[model samples]
Target: MTASESMATDRPDDLPLPPGPNSYPVVGNTLGFLRDPFAFYDSLDDYGDVVSYSVAGEEFCTLLHPDYVEQVLVTEESKFGKSDFVQDAGERFVGNGLFASEGEFWRRQRTLIQPAFYRERIESYTEPMVEFAADAANSWIDGETVRIDEVMKRLTLRILSKALFDLDIRNQQSAIRDAVNAINEKGDAGSVDAFLPDWVPTATNRQFRRATDQFDDVIGTLIEKRRGDPPGDDFLSILLHATDERGEGMSDKTLRDEMATFLFAGHETTALALTYCWYLLATNPGVRGKLNDELDSVLDGDTPTMADLRDLKYTDKVVTEALRLYPPAYVVFRQTKEDVNVGGYRIPAGTSLTFPQFLIHTDDRWYDDPDEFRPERWTPEFENSLPDYAYFPFGGGPRHCIGMRFANAEIRIVLATIARRIEFDRVAGGDLDLRMGTTLEPTDPIEMTVVKR
Candidate 1:
């Protein structure tokens, strides 16, 4: 037999999966965790770094340790491939776009779209991002209680709708939010709905179906409008008019999928990141004060210009450290297509591997006082030695976030705009219970009293 088979059969009779805590005959940790995922993970050590858990007979190993994560995310990424959850979700909404595709199809899409994120193209969006942020911040009620989470959510929504698509989702906001709300509400309702491969008449299924349709409608209209009258400047017009060196262009359906991919994937992740950023800043007075000082000294209470973002050094570090503490997309999964050796464990191909970024970000093994939100950790000196795969707030390798440059500029500018204008008092009962979904979140909505600075 081959070496890969040797490891799979290496399971001794007494070793139940040989990696994680022992299961209770068949149930695993299913009933034990409808809540408190952090505690669930903390208790998994009884089984070790690689362990098996069967959720309704679909068993996948939960991975621990940073070394194995690197193998999955960096070295053997192409083979491992994104799991079905993303594909199923994408196909249901946007058809077979980049996020929904793999192999040559996904690769071609990536190459075609890469220029849209070129430094010059991204730099152009900075003005719009700052403008939207300024309008949102102006409506904040000074010294009055504000749902900071809602404000940031709107800010990201506007940025995604207007700036990214150059069209407003505000018109379709109700349809979109309702669908996302249901998706979240039915939390962990099993991966069964995804496996159906077709929609059903169930209320939850209906909601998702309607939301995706509405999203497609919005994207479809935008694509058509841009195709007719190209703006020659914005993203939509660029995508509509883009031609290959050979004069080839994307199909109409392909254009729709790409736009949907950006719309669906980009907005929520950014909202979660901003929410956590505000919470961290509210709790840590010293960090908040220091950041405010940086904003005041550099931005001087003006809306951060595209040029100002270049000079806003500390703000980048702050957002970087915040992402480390609370990465928007907490876990990345890849299913091994062929047998692979990883972090000293040899396993047969088809093994599902998880790289829990949340664990790595908080673990002391990689960082000094990992829990502490020290923006200085990303200093020029320290940043040099930091591992490439270790601090990926936007992920890394070929599938890294496309709009990372845009996101960094957007977040820093918005944070500075809000920071220099107002201060937050943390809610006495502010509870940040992380919900493990598309993005982790504070279980309690963030309510804070904002005072004009």
Candidate 2:
């Protein structure tokens, strides 16, 4: 039956809720989910596509099917908004920037910020990305062990700072890195601190406050410096010069919020993607050989340029496959603005909906040997055969990640440039124990030995 027909036949009030595991009083499934989120979410697949669950007394319906993902993110998008918890949590961290704001405010902010990500503008970032990657790769001594995650984070942050703000932030890298880590730790879904009230006088709360303050200080100083100087061809300059039809531009506060959002979201997500890509390559010799062959043929020891991106086909697929296996933004949360029917289940208004890329991307129904790392499977024919949402490493729809293009370019350029200069061999860690934080993070640092190519 059609979705609308199903809804017509069974009003939300009359229909029974979707089947799911039973919940305990008060805490609901909070403890179980926190124990091991991957296993918990995977177990729900047996209950059906639309499974009802609760956490801390809040109701949620997880949509496992790609069709339902489309319904929430695309076609019926207006009927859903960012979930309440997300809005609240995001606002506390990044303020009412694009990631948190909604309605006309969000629309206006997006319109103002969109120009910075235009094709020509993003292409301009290629030089910094390649330069930073090459520098990082050259600095590594052969046979020296390094934390791959930290290396990627530092490299991506340098690229981001130069490309986005036209500033040298190496001096402040530690402060910014600490701040980001503190915030993520407090925001981790599995952490008890995540559920506590912000006003509470706990160590997590204190650390969170300190982190936000430190971040604000760093961003505030840079924005102030930019305002005093002549405009440059960077994102900060774009935001500073961006005026509305009424001839007004973003206020200092607004700029800080947006800057925080981009800096935090842009750098962190791409870093994780590159880190995971490296881990996968280290573990899979065949994939690494193929990637190296493509890099050798296309780049041949030269820094990658925007033009070379067209020929970096295998490199692109390797990144795509890595994202599929370990999407940084593991789960997206949305709330129903009105009662909605999905997968023959009637969901009431105000119910939270989860679109888990981590779970859906690995579902064997859409991907053969879904647990395996096979970049070769990303042929055009294979991609065309799957549902659109089945492979959305970046979330889909109008509200999809604004930096999707920027991040894609950065990941490819950095991966190609670094692979041309060096190779990584896993030293100790075999598999990642991922933590579902603001972004998917490895519970421990991913250590690898760098070998010059």
TM-score of each candidate structure, all chains considered together: 0.89, 0.97
lDDT per residue as tens, model 1, 125-179? 7776777777776777777887877777777877776755676664457755654
In model 1, the Cα lDDT at residue 416 comes to 81
lDDT of each: 0.70, 0.87
* Whole-model lDDT, model 1: 0.70
- The superposed Cα distance between candidate 2 and the true structure at residue 406, in angstroms, equals 0.6
Per-residue lDDT over 1-453 for candidate 2, one digit per residue giving the tens place of the 0 to 100 score: 543354344555666778999899888999998898878888898898899999866799998888889878998899999998777666666888888889999999899889999999999889889887888887889999999999999989998888778876766677677778777878899887776777888898898888888889888888888886776778999999899889989999999999888888888899999999999999999999988889898887678998999999999899999999999999999999988778777788999999899999999989999999999999999989998899787898989999999999999999999898788999975568989898999999899999998
- Give me the runs in candidate 1 sitting further than 4 Å from their true place: 1-18, 24-29, 32-36, 169-172, 182-201
Top-TM-score structure, candidate number? 2
Model 2: lDDT to the true structure: 0.87
Specify the poorest-scoring 10-residue window by lDDT in model 2. 2-11
Q: Which stretches of candidate 2 lie over 4 Å from their true place?
A: 1-11
